[model samples]
Target: MWPLRQMLQPRHVLPIHFDNIIRINILMMQVKYCAGKNIPFFAQNGGSGWAALNLTNGIIIDILPLNKVTFNTDKTQATIGGGVSVAEAMAAGAAAGAFILTGNCDCVGALGAYLGGGYGNLMGAYGFGVDNIISFNLVNAEGELKTVTEASDPDLFWAVRGAGPNFGIVTSAVIKSYPDSNLTAWSTALVFPGEQITDVVKAVEALRPNLKPSQNVFLYLTNNNGPVILVTGFLLHATVEEGKAAFAGLYALNPVFENSGVLPYAQWNAGAASFCLREQRKPGHSVGISQLHPEQWQEIWDRYVEFRNKPGAENSVVIIEIYNLAKGRSIPSSTASWPHRDVNAQAIVIPWYTDASLDNDAIAFAQKVRNIWKSTETKSTTYINFAQGDEGLEAIYGDSLPRLQTLKRKYDPENRFNQWFNIQ
Candidate 1:
């Protein structure tokens, strides 16, 4: 605490290790300084969809020292630092013979992803990442460091769980973990020719009703020379014997390339994260649907083909992540600002262009896909983290839009934390 007090300057410095509570207080003081003086700041981590927002003239704070994950003596729960990545958190939990909910991307910030209704392979079994969180210790707009939990401050806690960045600098959180230390899992990545894209989507949709809470599937469309091809990934938290029935329909598709095996849960969760696009800060847009009929899936495939055929769009890609919602569907919409719970899938468009003249075309292409789905969307919600551009309040927050705005007024009255998707 003494060292941090001496070092708490207004400028960003490389994070230095400090005791947990002391580090939280130091960050609270820094946030308070910024809030009190009306100086805006941005807390940067991964910045997965951060570039689309307006961050003009705000200071950036690096809070990496808070990236610690510790298990309780009895191992029912674990306290995680805000800066920890999925890879770090998963390994930490597995060390204690436990597991926690996290996204597929190993390098994505753990708390950041959880704060946005994190979707992952574990979601089918454990629900979204927010479902595992127990409490959060954050620096609010007032610069006061407060420990928030369902019992301590339900309203702020509800808002913080998924609608983060709208409130403050979350230093750490306590979350429920699963007892799957020895759980063996399976992952399958299958590639199909361009024409067979519909078969893959149909295969997934057909298996949706049979999918256990432990299974997850995602489809990817990208350029194969000139025509669009499909790549599919299937993950099951259970071993092959328990998961075989769930995968029977998928195997019938006869993919061009297939890989499936038994592996540690941690290894499957990590998946081919090396292939995740880390550096290209291109414009992207996303749309969510609970379930799409075969016709709708065909429409999405058709759109992907069109996007790939555009000039300088050779590197563009589309990823449709399927959320079986096995355990995730039972939650109340008010659980967090992320409104859609029954959504069976979400699709995102990443447009990379080499020609400056095609910038508008690229963004329009992404939005057109989103708009096409938006017209038929049963629920007016989009997953917060995967969303881009200026989607309306209803689309991002759903029925909880008004309540979140009110919470924004109560907590961040001046909206000091408005850089990243502003709640107001």
Candidate 2:
């Protein structure tokens, strides 16, 4: 089953025909046909999800043709097609002089990320991607198109904001956009030798409590030629000096390599383009942590170094993403189904490799890292987007499990849209 799931990914190589869904009506028709026939189906978003799926036998609905992004006249809102990638939305937002809350990566589907509690660089300032959404153009289990908004359907709207894929297929979404006529951000990439892991981790811990809403930092234990600690700090609407001051704790460490500059909003994600490469067996595991333990991170770095040296596995990366959740936390947890508002940090390990022979090795290494993270975690949880499909409902949905389950029974009794994180 694992091998079959792996083969189903990198879908281009499979000898199967897909129904290209370009319009909402067409997508609805396909859904109804598959539901009536009792044939399982999965909708392809950005084609970037690395979770293990049971697409053993199903028709793939190619929603890539639905990719479209348009902003309103005042650049205050955007109508994003379900297939739009983060890169597409970012480019469109840049052209329209607005800032859209999107994931940090470029290739992930914008709506797909939003559906799982969107965490992005701008989330500290604006809010989660789910918070920005105004309404959805959803196609339900019965293949009926429904315009869902807070005023129209509060329950389904709340469900779709966090656990959408399990309820229906959203053809398009209307999301709040901010006008950013001056859309420049300051960012720096800092590299440290593996030996500096403790100092780096401690410095990050010291800075975490002081993180401003306009600032965010990402830490990566990856192979840059060899095992190295990479840190990228970003400050929105700030000068270079301000960016430096915000991350002064890290700068005090005197990194081996440093590159800092102010970039246009369009180029904020340029550094992450390399991570967006498609079609590799990237089985990623993640956890939401309430605190950062420096000693544990040192151990993680040691383990990362050991696995990174393996042949054909140097692309594996361990990333920790931290943000100021004050704004997102300001919103009530009951407002939507996303359950990780109080989590201080999110960590993920991607065991990237293409050799089928190394599948077991990669999974072992990833699980080991996840276990290490869980050992020190006060409350074990995982962001739905970063999950690898091995978690229980409590771990993924947190306290929202009971309500989401009830909504699942109400909205999708037959469980047709169970491709991602199913409610039941």
Candidate 3:
């Protein structure tokens, strides 16, 4: 069989703890050793692979052991270690009767997503993962631990919130927690075959401008024979009545399939993480568009149908996330490098391929699919995790790119952290 015997494995792994700041600084100092040994070093936890399109291949540092969430005495905020997954943070905060701003997927590293303008069902309520951050334990390029906060270093703090990896290694972060006003959470998935994609797109467009702050609707389509599924989730609900109302506009389309229910917040978090990516999937190439225009939507549907016929693309998927931009904008625009706060949503094309030969075609087709939606975008902004490589500075960080470049130089002058998205 023509196959790779094994995936590219890390050559070395360095694990650190929350109590051992000295050890982390020592690991930071190891960069000198890496220089002398002529090896590249990189750090990761949870392995979400959202921070960059390319990955570091040598001397990998596994920072997954720093997985603890400790609340302050007043219980106003919770400090999470870099190794904590979304699931762990939610569990720890739930025990303390607090809700932390977290991405819906429980499997992803909490701090990495938080640093990159993390969007979630609660985004309309809490703004963004970056908005709730208070402080951090950052190891700079000089191998020194610096406590970064709004008062101590406002410029660095602002940059790190959305561009953390571009600056240094974040060992841990302190962020605020809140009370969940909605005692219950609800979600419904509506099924529509290829024939009804146009109607579904228009209906969603009609509702997009008027979507409530507590509601999030996503359009999910697989390259397989499955029908397009429009999933709507409600965060502000005590009764099914509110959830039902939130989805009434879409229900008028008379979906062929539907599933609706309520569950605990923690359960919801786990459910969302496993919703689409239930299995360990192959490395995916993805790109995002700021909004979905009607003409672009039709083109996207046509292109997706064509892509579905391609060999490996059959198992791939397209995700249209209708975000609560109105709510996300409540956070100051200057706080981070994520500049697409006013956009309505994102249309992401995820192309997954197994063999190395299929990689180029998958990425090219995925970029084409994204280009259809991008044509309709008034703004060039997109999410960090949703980006495909070659988008350039404006597309990823928008106007904030210049400021980020200065901070990158000031903090990481030699560009040790450029392995991820770089300011250069």
Candidate maximizing lDDT = 2
List candidate 2 stretches off by more than 4 Å.
1-6, 9-22
Model 1 TM-score, all chains together: 0.89
Question: By lDDT, highest first, what's the ranking?
Answer: 2, 1, 3
Top TM-score: which candidate number? 2
Off by over 4 Å in 1: 1-22, 223-228, 231-237, 240-244, 274-276, 296-299, 309-313, 353-357
Estimate candidate 2's alpha-carbon lDDT, on a 0 to 1 scale: 0.86
- Location of the lowest summed lDDT over 10 successive residues in candidate 2: 10-19
| Candidate 3 local lDDT, 341-371, one digit each (tens) | 7666777666544656765666567778766
Give Cα distance to truth, residue 5, candidate 2, Å. Answer: 4.5
Q: Write the per-residue lDDT of candidate 1 for residues 1-424, one digit (tens) a residue.
A: 0101121243444252587777777777777777777777777555455236443444567777778999888888898898887888888877888878788777678888899888887787788888888998888888887889889888998888767888998888899887654656766666777677667777877766666667667767776686555544455555565555567776677777676677776686554553355444357778787664666666767776776687767767777777668587777666766677867678777776555576677777778777776677666567888777477767777777688899999988888888666878
Clashing pairs in 1: 124-213, 290-344
Scored against the true structure, residue 276 in model 3 reaches a CA lDDT of 34
RMSD of 3: 3.4
TM-score-sorted candidate list, best first: 2, 3, 1
lDDT of 1 at 390: 70
Instruction: Give TM-scores for every candidate, taking all chains together and pairing residue i with residue i.
Output: 0.89, 0.95, 0.89
